[model samples]
Target: MGITQVQRLSAGALKPLAALVDDLGLAAHFQGDAMLNGIDPVIRSPHRLGEASGTAQLLIGIAGAAVWHARTGKKTDIAIDIIDALHYLHPTHFVQQQGQPILVDAEHVEVNDIFLCRDNRHVMLEAGPPYMKLLKGYLNFFDCGNSKKSFAREVAKWDSEKLETAMATAGLPACRAFSREEWLAHPQGAALGQVPVIEIEKIADGKPVPFQTPALSPLQGVRVLDFTHVLAGPRSTRTLAEYGADVLHISSPAYPDTFAQHIGVDVGKRCAYLDLRNADDLVTMKRLAARADVFTNTYRPGVNARFGLLPAQLAAASERGIVCMTANAYGHSGPWAERPGFDQNGQVASGFAWKEGEPHKPRFSPVFYLGDLMTGYFAAAGMMAALLRRSTEGGSYHVTLSLTRSAMWVQELGFLETTRQASLPERDSYPARMTSIDSVYGKVSFLAPPLTFSNLALPNASRLSPYGADVPEWPA
Candidate 1:
């Protein structure tokens, strides 16, 4: 099996939203008392229409020392393992690895700890007394802008040796930067099993017909390893699982469980946690990949390959398997590949931000990660096609789909056409005549004053539910 990167949810202080998930019996599988902290209430709250959903979401940011006290009563040493996990997740951490000198922000709990703590492998329980808590609180109240001035004296007093000691406590590792392809090409990558596909078309009246259904159920026995998180990636996988892919979610011990619960994305899948940093955990992931036919993740290109879940690697492990079928707001190439992207950024880039909804006054809907989600579905369809090809040809295929590409497809019909075009006026000359308002918006409205078609049935002899509805027997 290849060395794949995995993250875990923090065992630090829990946030109010995380508590809500537990109280509501959501994420019941997350048994660890280690709290999920550092959630911004504005982002986490569900009160605002289409905005805050007061839902528990996966938070990948740093935690404050006060977070532990805010939720947990007992004062305990924060684990170095937790710190290491945060370092890998934090954007600043990545910048530092590039040898960029970052003027550490003492106001930021994680940043402060990076300067104060040294080792990267120790457990939080081993850290000294409640000092971490006091420091966290101080940072919380401290003026963020004046961090350099506020921490100047301490910074001066704490020499290189003291800083080294603190660094030792963090238990972090210096990973050599590897390209996405290099990461995917690791020898151990041959663990995830093959993904197969078959093409089927409907036949009616002794002729081939397009396949369509009241409810689409194209995937039956297929299994997916849902490694992607957040609304876009999760919702995409959820849609597939809803239709019928046996989705097994692989999560980091470091990410919040409430994220899946609040968004209602885990409904059709079995979820399990894995720590990618641990050798044994990587083995477990490989084993799971060995059985999973498809794998979806949100990490930008190189990240997954470093931990070993690349398409080539997956194909090597399982002949004809579809390894990486996920969407990146930004295409996998270009200078932006290393930078993180989200739906908002994608909207801005796709020109939809300027022209959508109000003219010159673009307003956004509550569509979190719509671009990624749609891209994911399109990617899923492509994977299905590739799987079919592999089954017939016995060769592997790499499939990629992007939101930008999809947006272009959407715009093509109007903007990039070669055939004769029809001009659509802003307002139609005939309002009632042009539109069949009834049944237009998923409502049962009278059409043409309830026209009685000559051949229409006189109505059912009796209401279908006249004898009362058949009650479903669900377990109490």
Candidate 2:
């Protein structure tokens, strides 16, 4: 059934608050089956109307306050509480002020003004008018039923005329929007095309190669110099590594170790560090790239390129030929390129935030980094293909993966045939499935009969042997 006009109007009202919604990461909680089952009426009802206004503003405000306090380093309990809630938002087109608390407001409704005390021991909330006070509470603004209804009523009054007025007077932020047709018409549709031939091979000890097409293995023999920090870039290279490429990860002295701790996919790699700001460090990195078949990095755009890491600039460093893979939350072309971003911004820009379920519920797993990881995969794939072509035909290659494009690419599975004028089958004889493997301490084993099928499956966590000192050996 078609959505009612009221639903559309509600969606329009909720548009301005989309950033906040993405920030909180609440899509799965607000939609379809979830709308019927999720909790909290205030955040849930407007979600029923297909909009998430009050909930969004509430989250954005809370996130702002929590992020603000993270800088103070003392009395951070309050900040920590909200900080976890706020992490769901990423790829934001903004950077927080280094030493200040974030203040979030919407149409004069101040949702939060929280402080992370300098001592890093506690958290405090500045008071707000009662109507706007819910922002300081649980990151879920929809928890306050009265405030949610009130916010919904306020949003219902916003329409195209009101938006046009805001744009005309407030100087709305310039953002990119692609029509369904425009996106389909993009020249790189060839990249999205799916070739029909398939081959599944057990390549790695515990990994299965699924759905091999002529278009794949394009990244074979390419060695990538990975200078990415955090989940996005590292995860990208992991995908490349999956495609049978050697990836050397270079960290910086200033880099954080949290990524390696929390992410498991990066288990099979080596690491090194270079302080790129130093002359010697820069020289070393350049030399490494000279031997690298590809270079991948994800620091805001132009920051590294100026130091000779960008595609055009890296041409001078190639010894074995290089394919540079660059990833950014926003594409290099936008006003927001230099602005800080994470998955949150991508979710917002790509319409994932809007369709997300039950407005008040915070989004889940903004951690996916589907774009960055896939971009890494595509980058590796592209570089491999480019390298093969170079060997036979010859030339340098550059590949770009944008958070925005990657976000849109997620929908390609459903959109390709219609949008790209490509042929795709409705079903497959060999469907893509996740196989599970187990490990007992350091030894890995699979749950199968003596005679098992060939295919590498993703490893899963299993109970370790608690044999206390001397452990018995398993028979081969």
Model number with the top TM-score: 2
Q: TM-score of predicted model 2?
A: 0.45
> Taking the tens digit of each residue's C-alpha lDDT, what string does model 1 give over 331-397?
5545333434444334433443333322333222222223443454445444554333333343445
Model 1: how far residue 56 lies from native, Å:
28
Regions of model 2 farther than 4 Å from truth: 1-221, 257-265, 358-369, 412-476
List lDDT for all candidates, in order: 0.36, 0.37
* lDDT for position 83 in model 2: 21
lDDT of 1 at 395: 46
Candidates in order, TM-scores: namely: 0.42, 0.45
Error of 2 at 69 (Å): 55
